[model samples]
Target: MHQIKRRSFLAATGAVLISPRLTAQPAEASQPGSLGASVTIEREPLHALPRTQYGHFLEHLGRCIKGGVWAEGESEDMFLGGIRRELLAEMRAVKPALIRYPGGCFADGYHWRDGIGPRSQRPLRKNLAWSRLGQKLGPEEDNHFGTDEFLRLCEELGAEPQLTANVGSGTAAEAAAWVEYTNGPKDSKWGSERVKNGHPEPYQVKYWFIGNEILGWHELGWQKPVQYVETLKRYAQAMRRVDPGIKLLASGTFGPNPNHAEIHQTLLQGAGDHFDYLSVHLYATEWVAPRNLWRYQILNRQRRPSRGLYYEIMAALSVQQQYLEDCISDLRQFSPAGKPIKLSFDEWNLWYRGYSDLYQSNFNLRDGLWVASALNLHHRYAQELELANISQMVNCLGLIVSTNQGTFPTASALVFRIYTENVGDELLPSQVDGPALPHPTGLPVLDVSATRQGDTLALFLVNRHLDAEVSSRCTCQGLQVGTVAKRVELHHPDAFKYNTYADPRALRISERSETLKVESDGAASRFSVQLPAHSLTCLVLEAKNL
Candidate 1:
């Protein structure tokens, strides 16, 4: 038997343990590979990267809301507000701009009334939507983390509250009342009820989602495209009657699924005039049978670079991006009046592998790289994507995982922070000239996106190569490349490595300042960077002149 460190053993076996630091120091510089790429970032801005694009989601199902975020027992500190203090601190650090609550499938069945009263008085209802496989009802949903709690959590985290209303089993009047309760004046009936619940002032939630995946077969109240269009229009009209100022989002297709084209067409034809944003959900995963879970795990452990899983995932995203563009084009044709219908990619992540339940997913270093690539895709379609949320904030495909000891920010969370915390405001046009990979979809091994915020120019590069590092040179055409301010690289020796509760620092981000030799050619400036194999790197450069 091999002798392993206690923490390493525990981590390998999926045990929780806390680490002293979230990120580790960089490894020593080594010989670079022969692959060379050049990224040219156009200084002229294309579009503004909306802060809401960095939003997160919180669903009522699983441990995401219950044990993960809201604590049940007494805390040593009263000010902790019954929620996990550590989770709260971690959320604050990541600084998500917006958080959508009570949802995915849970939104279809949730009632606002059940969650608003005092904790003891709140009802324990059966979660009909997100139940275990072969089981009619999932877990007993104790309405502990209801509307008030979600709003309070958002407030605590300094995130804008985006609420999803129940349209499946809920009445239009109920949906209207929820809007009133959240945004109406205290004199209003539902608003007065909200005031009585201790929040005298309205929560003033700005974004409201009509339903969640109402067209999917697994959804609680699955309906045809035509049926959902009418349902969405009714819900939108009623809700907006109460507060017309609130932005309404209608549930959209799962991206590029042929079966959903009708849904997209019907939605634009019928409900397009009512809603401001069309919400799309995408989850990337290599499917395997539930019975073959153990076998799949073994195979995953032994899988080689030939698997091409990473490239496949990136290519799939590109396909989805094209699908989104097609949807936008359809929207343009449907509403010739030029009524803008932005996409709200509210639920997205890599969630293929299942554990005790379908909602749970294991996050690894590869998943972090996948997330980085996904963020890059979002940047590519920044103009179309008004808002996006990484599904289930604390658990259930969450970026941060909660344990009994505390909360651990996973590899995905670090990637989220690296982009959400450091990426610039204005997205710049960037083109990568590099060798293509062997995948059927010939995507460059070097994936890159650039942004400019005032005097700072940030380049987000993802080396999609599974085995080889790329030494790349970046050229800024519009702006002169000044001194390198920060270079944050996230990579692990083994792509399979992940951050577990016991080893929270296993796959961590490493940040360091790099000396850049800026060569100025009459109009453009160029600098060099080395992207490690299977790594996500963000280089922030200070422009020569503001």
Candidate 2:
């Protein structure tokens, strides 16, 4: 039997050994010893560079609508500092290229006209869907934040506005008029009215969605596939006639399956060419765990529920992907549009629990690292998937969490902010290798992706191991790598260590660097990296181009 030495074992696996005697260097040291031998890496070029805007979304659910962008005093006259400046600043910091608004299910029952006009005149309608505490039940639904408010917020945030037209419980005319109000120039009545409201500028938001999740009616009423598609088609036609520059997206099903695929294919066939993007939702959690306690529950929620649980989830993801494939596949067969229809995975997060009356949770360090891992998945698959949002932006499973007094960045948000900034736009070629190391629970080793910005190459690594550490060599192919420019890691002894506004550092990308080791030859260069078990790290490599 081959016996591994203690140092070799520790360095190879990149672990934080629980045994008291197993100390190497401090956790912050670069040369924490070495494994038995060096590993060789082959070269490969990354492809299908996606635009940065491929990561964004909006849903007027949870605190996202009430306390988030729709702050209290947005209007000139009806002002009271309702919007959270700090929260807005945090979101702006993310540099979202586009933001869809006004609903998740909230879009289904929304009346755009109600959210317009004078606050005093705006009628009070019972928010049947999201009001868990019955907060909007009394006099709170006076409609403080309306169309004008959202447009202004968009401008302030420097993001493209993606408004969802009311399809369920609304007519095509209502959707058209709303577009006219936002995009129409000053001469028209609606345009003039917008000018009179305080701002004379036409809010030219070219991207719009016909409806949001109309097929599912949990809180809001549901529309059958045919009805939803037809309504969306009508809305698309009228919206385009008013502003031909508009980019529209049809609502795809919740996940993968023949039913969902048929729904997407049918919808696309009816209104495929008219739209520019398709919307879908995905969440990683134990929601799909099997009933057998052992079968369903995995030690790590970040990974799929062991192998047994993923059987359903992967099938679901496959269903969603096939639907997307079919939409474009079918559309291309008929319409000769230059660009393929893109995907907007607008609503997604690791939602296992915590969706209750409040719908908010302070994600721990493990959750944060997982958030980064999921985002890395987005970067790797950027060719097909574009515009992915981590569900709620602020409170309520948001990247950033809030309190009645103040707000702070969540672990997930921090990781996302770091990953996005470095990897945006600079497309390069990269790849991952290592056998599929399955956990005792049966999930495979973590996933990773790479990209480049200028001469800087970014390597995003994720370790999905729960109880054990993974020993794998990550080798970048083809490029001549220099010293490691920066290294940021998010990890903790416990997966549940989270950040609070007062002590946000409780669990974070606690340490980072602009230094590392790079070795190469005339043919190719490689940077050595060790991903901590159950953690995520980004290795920045500056290439020496010949």
Candidate 3:
């Protein structure tokens, strides 16, 4: 792991090194009559970008657990806890802030008891979530990877464990018991059971989700808005009785829909005081077909609209961000006085049609750009979005894909690495004045977020344009720019390009030193750089006088 230098800023100069495949047009081919994009960074600091925003999720579905992180058979390279040593190493490298376990609808039907106790004695149960619709039921869950194992994995990776308790098929007593086992004192009954399970000390997990999408009809025991709110209150009350310090996240909306409004209203009115965070899930997919069968048939017979899929996804993300803000406002209006509710975007990613049989999504360079933009959105809305988890951590919409042979870090993983490594502590507001992109609702060609820590500042930018490279001038108002500290770019010639085991380097991050020039007047220093089309870049700079 490369340690990020805390105090110093490094700079890189020249045109960004672009992959030959992606750079079909020369840098001189700027849009006709287009002015250079300019970004102004405000000195006033927003709240610290919560570390918890850099979290990941893990579910029991598919190879994410049984074969991905926890290998069944022992090998020389396996960790002592029977997990894949290679996966652990990869997870540690990203320094994920949290890992939500046993879910994404799976939690709604899961029975915590089935996973506790001796592995040999653990029973194999049918997984109702990840199975084919009408063919075979889901695979058998051996109950090998349960609560304890999850806590251990979090410990190994220095991540907090965010457990989603079963509210669909399990009762409040069961949820309370799981909490007791995890955090109750030694004298408590379930705590004693924890000792019997060979863990004498409590896991002291801080984050817990009440349920996993219980309002969705596809969930195991889907409930109506009112019913789910009542259940959430009961579960939150019971679990808090077991451990009062734990933070509970109530399952929120799927998106900006009528059900979303009703659900949030009911939860805030009925159970607002019980939970700390409202969990929401966001997944974007390109328009594959028309809504009507005739239109779809006609469109399919003609030609699929391949262009602007990336921009469409980005526009959807922008809409989702607005929806989230509206939800937060509703929470404020509905909650009791002095009680506040924040957002936990626990599930988010670019999920589309091409998923493997094992539920793994083929993440591509376009997806990496989407991840970068989505992360910037989170940072932009950092105040309301207290926590977020990128759907799954391994093999299932994950940044890292695990196989029988080894683990491969996807292009999206490099985005995670870059942000987690380079982003500063406090988010600073930044505005970009640039030419508009044709798609994705005419969003600016340059999307940016800035962060500051003492004398250092980091800028994260995503050029949303598909065909034109953006030349942008950045000016920091309050801070004097001394030097360029580091420049990291993640891009490829082909937006659809993805990483595979055969050629894992197909889309990866590149680092180069770029020149930084101080403005002649020295009032506010500026830097110039060209942002590649469909790319994400991070630039670190040092403050001159601080």
Alpha-carbon TM-score of each model against the true structure: 0.89, 0.79, 0.89
lDDT (0-100) at residue 98 of candidate 2?
A: 67
Q: Write one digit per residue (lDDT tens) for candidate 1, span 154-189.
A: 888889999888877888899899999888899999
lDDT of 3 by residue, 191-297 (tens): 99989987899999999998887776656677888898789889988999998999999887765565566668888888888898988876654432212234334
Runs with alpha carbons beyond 4 Å of true place in candidate 1: 1-32, 78-80, 132-137, 288-315, 355-359, 544-546
Where does candidate 3 have its weakest 10-residue lDDT segment? 9-18
lDDT of 2 by residue, 240-259 (tens): 77888888877775544456
Worst 10 residues of 1 by lDDT: 13-22
Comparing candidate 1 with candidate 2, which one achieves the higher lDDT?
1
lDDT for model 1 comes to 0.75
Clashes of each: 4, 15, 13
Q: Which residue pairs in model 1 clash with each other?
A: 16-501, 16-502, 17-501, 17-502
Query: Cα deviation in Å at residue 67, candidate 1?
Result: 1.3
